[model samples]
Target: MQAQPEKKHSSTCDSKEDSNKLESRYQFCGNALRITRDFSNNLGISAIIWESGLVLCRYFEQEKISFSGKKVIELGSGTGIVGILAILLGGDVTLTDQPVVLNQIEFNVTSNIPVSIIQRSKVSDLRWGKNEDQFPTDYDFILGSDIVYSPHDFPSLIKTLQHLSNQNTIIYISSKMRETMGAIDFHEKLLPQHFNSELVHRNEEKEINVYKVTKKAREQPSA
Candidate 1:
């Protein structure tokens, strides 16, 4: 995780949260999490809870995915629920999105995580490909939920994934199969071109697919 900035504002509310605020609650790891949603921001989409994120959390529990003692990072963390769950499971987790969403994520993280475990959670701004190099590439696990909805961001997203991963980093991406927005195409076509991807779990009822990805082995040149 990148070093936390010193002058970060402690935001109690924005005009968006002031008027259109809502709480989306969930039970995980025997505790309830209340994620705040704001619908008025320009990036309002990230302020709301998405079903893909919930499905991903369920997948982790059902598969007994272990994040304990691992260095983990989550990209496009909207309400920060997935990364928060990872922290609860003992991962040193960094939750990231555009800068505008950091306050919302920070608010949820502080509210849900107990003081003892909250130190393991960090909130940062990661604009996909632009400044990924500022972060380390040796994370044990990388997570993304509902991040592949737009075809426009695919190249940058793939580049960012490549930049942040090493040979052993395990990447988990959970997305709703939104054919209209090219989410399905990203998994079925673009992602495999860079990583060895496996469809580890699918929730047909929710139309969510969780892919387990690892760096593709580089070919050995002929001697």
Candidate 2:
């Protein structure tokens, strides 16, 4: 789906008026992930690291989910934190976002992932449903964090999700539940109609939900 050009997300970003380079470090899987947020550009929401991404990483660690040798792809990979972590966990990960944010994400990936393990990760530009055909649907895992804030982008987002997943593909979508952002409706109402969605974890303190999703079986035609 084609989302509006990256613009400022006042409600979600830290309360910093002036645009500048902000660096943050995180520890996961025995690696320190160094991410840089460049607010000087029009990358908007994607420039900053969201809490949903951190929560998802935590879920992976807590559940002991092994991405070893799995083909994984992350959508709307802001700052590329989650995708980078997946790589650290032994997954071959592709990080996708708008063209504007690709450079920053690539930087983060290279900064965090060691040169030996870095080969497992790459960055791409994905306009949701518009160019989903460019990607193969054989991924073992599809990852996303805070990608569902706009209702206008829901149709394309859903279409993209469907295109990238097959019967066995597992999707992990971590989102901050904001009533204004329609996170509840997307997770509770819309996603169920398209896939078998499960609420694997809910962080009440952060108001975030991590859903484990898989494709719905095709209905058989009855005579």
Candidate 3:
């Protein structure tokens, strides 16, 4: 993903995590689903979109879930596949990232989605706590992938989470746990703030975890 810089004092809370390099490949899934290389993160993560995102789409198609007709937001949407999936399902979506990565995210979403899936979704640049003033206070849902890595980003991330969410909203996140002590512990402490959080799905063989969050309260941290 492309990146935008953070000016000084904007994020005294930013923390650096270990960096790893990843290669590229595009994999095909069932009809209406496809996987492709995301150059963002320098290709560090696979950014798989099928099951995680397709499940969301299928439920809505089956009328088992309601996203197509609601406002949605996704944070750290690397390739922005999930947010676009919601858009296909009929939700108004805000696709957010650090300004640098927004372009890459937009590239993937625009290229893969069908023109028939008409919906409103934006590539909004968001650097947690740095531009707090620009944050929106209301959204129906928030989604993400592999966002719980850097502790430095956690506080600000949580701050953004609380800011965008309201009583009736849901916050969804999915990530494959990496072999890092700090990364594993982030979910431990961060889990408590969310009113309800449960592991909805996972791939134990791949070390991935998907959690659904709802029932948030407003507790503005000085992030």
Give the TM-score of each candidate. Answer: 0.89, 0.90, 0.69
Counting clashing residue pairs in each candidate, in order, gives 0, 2, 8
Lowest lDDT sum, 10 consecutive residues, model 1, at 2-11
Off by over 4 Å in 1: 1-19
User: For residues 1-223, what per-residue lDDT tens digits would candidate 3 score against the true structure?
Assistant: 1211211111111222223322222222222423244444553443434344433333233333557668888877766766766776667888887766676667666765666664476778887777755867677888877777787788887777777777888777766566473555666567666656766655554456666777655679997
Candidate 2: what lDDT? 0.85
Stretches off by above 4 angstroms in model 3 are 1-64, 116-119, 179-181, 217-223
Clashing pairs in 1: none
Model 3: lDDT of residue 53: 44
Per-residue lDDT tens digits of candidate 2, residues 38-123? 77777888887888998888787766688999999999998998998899899999999999999889878878878978889989
lDDT of 1 by residue, 1-223 (tens): 2211112211122222346677766776554677787665666688767878877787776655779999999999988999998998889999999999988889889988899888899999899779898899999999999998889899999999999998999999988899999987899999999999988777766778888899998899999
Winner on lDDT between 1 and 3 is 1
State each model's C-alpha RMSD to the native: 8.6, 7.2, 11.9
